[model samples]
Target chain A: MIVKDAVCPFCGCLCDDIEVEVEEGRVVAVTNACELGTTKFMGEKRMKNPILRVGDEWKDITYDEAVKYAADMLLAAERPLLYGWSGTHGEAQCVGVHMAELIHGVIDNTSSVCHGPSILAIQEVGHPGCTLGVVKNRADLVIYWGSNPIDAHPRHLSRYTRYAEGFFLENAFRDRKVIVVDVRKTESANIADEFIKIRPGGDYAVLSALRAIVQGKADTIPRTVAGVTREQLVRVANLCKSAKFGAVYFGLGLTMTQGKYKNIRNAIELVSELSRHTKFTISAMRGHYNVYGSNEVNTWMTGYPFGIDFSRGIAFYNPGETTAVDILARKECDAALIVGSDPAAHFPRKCLEHLAEIPVVQLDPYPNATTAFCNVQIPVAVTGIDAEGTAYRMDGVPIRTRRVLSSDYLSDEEVLARMYALMQEARER
Target chain B: MKVTLAMKPAAKWFIPIEAESIVPKNFLSGTDLRVWRGNRELRLDEVFSVSVEGDADRAEDVEVVLSGDTFRLKRVGEYLDAGKITVLGGIGMHCGNFMSGGTIEIHGNADGWLGREMAGGTIVCRGDAADYCASGYRGGRKGMKGGTVEVFGRAGDFLAESLAGGTVIVHGDAGDMTGAEMRGGTLVVHGDCSRPAANMKDGSCYVYGTARGMIPTFKKIGTVQHDGRTLIRFSGDLANRGKGNLFVKGYEYLD
Candidate 1:
């Protein structure tokens, strides 16, 4: 049986035109999906049973026992930190927020590590953002700053930025001017019309120079700012100013480097400033498939998007403080309820030590590093594969993840709901 | 009177307590304050053991000491006009956000957004600080308008970003962007930095240690003497016609 027009829940693109062929409850092939999406849809590897760590020994436990243990641990802890909803569905995240509120714990998502500064910058300067379709249709000038869409978002250039035929742009690649700006020459830079190599950590400077040049203050700019010559700056500025519509897609390179939020803020301000001459929009190239969903759900439920703390029985947002890294590094939380994120693999050494010290209960479809380090692990059905839920694209467009195959395992939302019910019962008692 | 708020172990929750209402200036000996835990309001006494000692008639004369992990307390001394507030343990985010005048000392580590958009104050963090220290609030153009933020230990990324005025000094290593897009201010980093003063329009950055790279926008001028130390001075965030100056102490020019 072939599932037509299925959403690929692997990256922020959230490509919904995928066709998955299922053979007896297993994904046999995935068409119209990138390699990464194919791997995700094909069920590369998955955990089938619930596991519990007893005295440093891994023991296979029933789902009921795992859920009970997870609930008890969360309810008993004075301070509990619930992290990671990026890989799951919005339904699961909503339940996770409720659970965090009910348990009076901190709930943070993957945005804290990646695109966090971009979110902060968006909140500061305001995002002149648009959907991928707009970029595909109207954007004549597409710039990729500190992002490599070729390796990260495989079909981004072909589907949205460069090659896709649109209403206004019939010869997409031929008509649009593709500019790639990065510290080093990346794969995407090789194919761009202009590749501007910038010094690492000089994004803010380069962006400021661009802003200056675009605003007709080119004479004041240095001969070479961030390794781009005066002529290059003038040309690029003129191109941006003259373009009917332009779009900039940024990635982790800007957020992870020095000047993190300021870099993104400068980029946003540049896009905003360019509005005087032309139409331009900026978007962060989100990594995780549903990470955008995580931020959106958290923002709607809690005023703040990420790093929400409910320790005092009120929702409080302060990124660095309530963030998972800081919370774990401080060893303030006694227990943790992690969902669909591997902190053990990604967190700093000090944070991982603290995470190991605490009792962690994880809900994931796979047995990854976090599950390995966790005390209780409950297996869940993968969304867009064996489970169905709503997911948000990078541009805040909601798409329903269709389950192509039926699984005996429970979904993340179901598991979380069960845990919430058990915790409520414990509290009532 | 010196006010002390000691946390009780049983008073743990995920929803952070907004304790800005419990500023020293607003508190009397027997006065009570209400803090929010999520949407619910709780008496300050219910969460912390509050006690007042020592006499004070003015906000500046009052000293407030908060003792606990305080990792869940948001905006502890927000908009503090005047007073001295100290955190005994690790503090949550926005410890001294938008404070016009005050002294906030954290004996332990502090989370992000410390002294955000502070107009005037002195913030001292004994331990490490998370990201966005001494930065503007979301959508705010200026950051740390006037204040002195001294971090004894390391600081996370985006330190003193979009700084408009005042001074920020880090005794230990800083993560990245020591002073990014700074319009006017003085940022001093004693330890190594990834990058300092990117897109700064008008300001001064002093790095006592190493910086990974210098933006081409800044022109290298001759050395200058400051506090008995010879430093390499560079002017211009020239990208935006900036006249910012960056001084790297103990930096030797490689031929």
Candidate 2:
């Protein structure tokens, strides 16, 4: 059986035109999905049952025991952390938020490590963004700033900005122009009509120079601003102003750099300055497939996007303090519950040192890096592969991911729901 | 009236204690206040040995003195409208948030978000101050609206960020992005800082030492004498409204 138009559960692109061929109960082949998506779809190394750490060894545990153990641990904790919702569906994320509220814990997602700064910047100056389809069909100029689409989002350039045929332009290839800006030349930069190489940790300065040039104060700018010649800056400003519609897509390079969100803010402010002459929009090149969905769910439910603290029985949102990395590094949270994503691989050493001391429970299909720190690891079904759920694209559109194959393994929603139910029952008792 | 509260050594000192109720107005009535250690709410006496010297009917007449292991104590004087708070040792994060009045004097080092969004007050920190000192909240447009924050020692990054109005004086060096997005404020850094007043809309920033990565947007407008020191004056950040004034003794551009 072939499942047509299956959403790829990989990057934030959420390409919904994937064709998955399943034989019996397993996926045999996938078409139209990128290698990253294909690898996840055809992957078969899945943990079958729950495992418990018995001192130096591991012991197989039933789902009921695992659920009970997780509930008990969270209930006894003074400050519990519910992390990793970016890889899961929105339904599971909702349950995770409820669990945090019930336990009066902190709930954060993968965004805290990635595009959390983008949200911070957006909060300062409102986002001027458009859907991917709009940029694909309408934009005559696309700027990939601090983002390399060729490596990360493999299909982002071909499907949305650079290679996609536009409705407004008669000759899409001839009329459209592409510019890539990075600290180093990337594969995406190789194909750009213009590539501006900047000094490392100099994005903020470069962005401010552009904004000044756009505001007709070019004389104030230095001869060379952060390795880019002033003449090049003025030329880029002119190109932006001359373009009928331009779109900017940035990645972690800008959000996780030295200046962090301030860089993104400066970029957005530049886009606002450009809007006075031409139509301009800026968006983040989100990594995780449902990371945007996680932000969306967290924002709608908790009034804040990510890194929320419910320890005081009120929703307190502060990224630097309540985030998982900071909380773990500060040795603040007593216990942690990881789902969807892994922190052991990405987090700093100080955070992992504290993670090793805490009682942790994780819900993931496969045993990843974070499993090494967990006392109990529950195997769950993968969303968008065998379990159907709602996900959000990078452009803030909700896409319903369809299951290409059926499996007996429980989904994240089921496991988290069971944990939340047990916790609620214990609270009532 | 004088109130002295000494901290009790906790089994878990790493977990911060939120004590926003320690303001002078809240203590005007009595010491019947609540504080939170993680998720557990405890009485004022549970975390501190409270002692009152005399009775006071008004908030201004009351004086609260905190001593001992107060580094992990957060939100000490939030929304403090009057009175005085003196920390003998290092104070925790959010020391004087949104304070419209009063004086906070910390003898030792201070943590992050010191005097955050403080509208009107005087915060005197004799020791070093951490990141976000006298800055705004996450994504807030205005930081220290109307207050005087005098840090005797060095300050961390993003000091007085989004400073809309008020005066901030650092006797020592400040970290990166000092007075960023400043609209209306007078910032004086006795020592060097990087990228002073980047993207500021309106304000006057005086850096007695070198300004590293001097933003390219500011236009030099001759030299001026300020506080008995001759400094080069510049009008910027042209990236924004270009109304802010920046004065630096020496500067280096990240050309």
Cα-based lDDT at residue A199, candidate 2: 90
lDDT tens readout by residue for model 2, B125-182: 9999998888998867888999899999999989999998899999999999999999
Worst 10 residues of 2 chain A by lDDT: A166-175
> lDDT tens digits, residues A1-429, model 2?
999999998999999999999999989999998899999999888998999999999999999999999999999988999999999999999999999999999999999999999999999998999999999888999999999999999999878888888888787777889999999999999999999999988899999999988989898888998899999999999999999999999998899988788899999999999999999999999999999999999999999999999999999987788899889988998999999999999999999999999899999889899889999999998898889899999999999999988899999999999999999999999
Q: What stretches of model 2 exceed 4 Å from their correct place?
A: none
| Model 1 misplacement above 4 A | B1-95, B98-114, B119-133, B145-255
- Provide interface RMSD per model, one decimal: 5.8, 1.0
> Which one is best on TM-score?
2
Best-performing candidate as measured by DockQ: 2
Q: What is the C-alpha lDDT profile of model 1 across A76-160, one tens digit per residue?
A: 7767889999999999999999999898888999999898889888887699999999999999999999999989999898889
- Computed on alpha carbons, the lDDT of every model, listed in order, comes to 0.85, 0.93
Q: B1-255 in candidate 1: lDDT tens per residue?
A: 789999766544544566778667877545588876544577889888988887877898988899975777878889888889989998877889888887999999998889889989899999999888998766567888998999999998779988999999999998766787789989999888866787788888999887765554566788999888788898857655679889986432110
Q: Candidates' TM-scores? A: 0.83, 0.98
| DockQ (model 1, Cα) | 0.27
